[model samples]
Target: MRFFWSTLSAIFVKDIVTELRSRQVLPTMIVLGMLIVWVLRMASEAILTSKAVMGPVALWISFLFSGLLVQERSFAAEQQHDCIYGLLLAPIDQGTIYLSKLLANTAMLCIFEIIIVPVVLVAFRLGPDTRWPALAGVLLLGNIGISSVGTLFSAVVRVSRARSSLLSVLVLVVLMPMMIPATFALLTVFGAVPETLQGTGALSFIGSFNAAVGYMIAFDAVFVVACWLLFGFAIKE
Candidate 1:
């Protein structure tokens, strides 16, 4: 157990340090995310009055696009100078590698969100009455869902010729299930659910913010465990 944690921390730290030195992944993600937010805000100017609807949509669209870059670059440093081979050869569990990478990616995305979320709220005019704690919870679960699956598939496509494009497609397709509930949860947090879904019925739970959050928790758990289990095989050369 100690060994597992130590290895995970060492690899996680290495990734953080590498990105800090290179200034590669995070900068691109932030710039692309900000640009995306700006473009969406501009394009949807007519609907800007609907902050409840547009704010969450814009925030997530920015996250999805910018987060793709993070996954695409997850193994880029390792691919250089055959460093991936060295990591694979070392006395480290592949699951450890996956966890470390997942943590690093989540950290980066969270930082991205910290910057972009405020800008989104301001641009969309989502006022101080917003349910910040609930929004934060939804974002954290969404991040885990994205980072877990993305990190796994990033390794799966690490050696492919069209890795960047392939990673984007795979992550998006696999994440659809999680993304829907997450987006709904975000809308619920922003108090944006339509009146139709609020009435009593089997479908009414969809309007319950906690239900969506619970679904995200389950999605994150299932994917993280499944990905951790399959990562060793996925990384095989």
Candidate 2:
């Protein structure tokens, strides 16, 4: 148990330090994310009048697109000097490697969100009624779900010639189930609960919100465990 955690920490730290030194992955993600947000804002000027609607759309779009970079680069970083072979040869479970990469990717995505979310809220003028705690919970769950599936497929496509494109397709396809519910949940959080889910009683905002949160929690748990179990096979030579 100790060895597993230690190895995970070592790998996580190594990735973080290397990224900090290189200034590669995070910068690209942030710039692309900001650019997406900016373009969306510009495009929506004449069409969308609802800040509530546009804000979440822009935020998630930036996240989904920029996030691809994080996952794509997660394993590609090690490919430069055959460092991935070193990780594979290490005395640790492959699941540990997966967890470490998942953590690293999630951390980067969270940092991206920390910077992007506030700028989004201010830009969209979401107002003081925005639910900060609930929004934070949603982002956290979404990050874990994204990172879990992304890390697994990132490893799967690590050696592919078209890994960047392949990773985007795989991650987006697998993420649809989670992302749909998540988008609705964000809509609710941003004060635009879908008309179908609005009204009093069991199908109210609180109920729908709880349902979305529960689904994401289940999705994250299932994928993380499934990915951990399958990572060995996915990563093998």
Q: What's every prediction's RMSD, in angstroms? A: 2.3, 2.9
Candidate 1 residue lDDT tens string, 104-213: 99998999999999999888778537577888888888998899988998888878899889988999999987777777787767777742366665446566667777
Candidate 1 ranges beyond 4 A from true positions: 47-49, 128-130, 194-205
Point to the candidate with the largest lDDT. 2
Can you give the TM-score per candidate against the true fold? 0.93, 0.93
Error of 1 at 166 (Å): 0.7
Residue runs of model 2 more than 4 Å from their true location after superposition? 128-130, 194-207
Q: Report residue 5 deviation for candidate 2 (angstroms).
A: 1.5
**Local distance difference test values of all predictions, in order:** 0.84, 0.86
Counting only residues 3 or more apart in sequence or on different chains, how many pairs clash (N, Cα, C under 3 Å) in candidate 1?
0
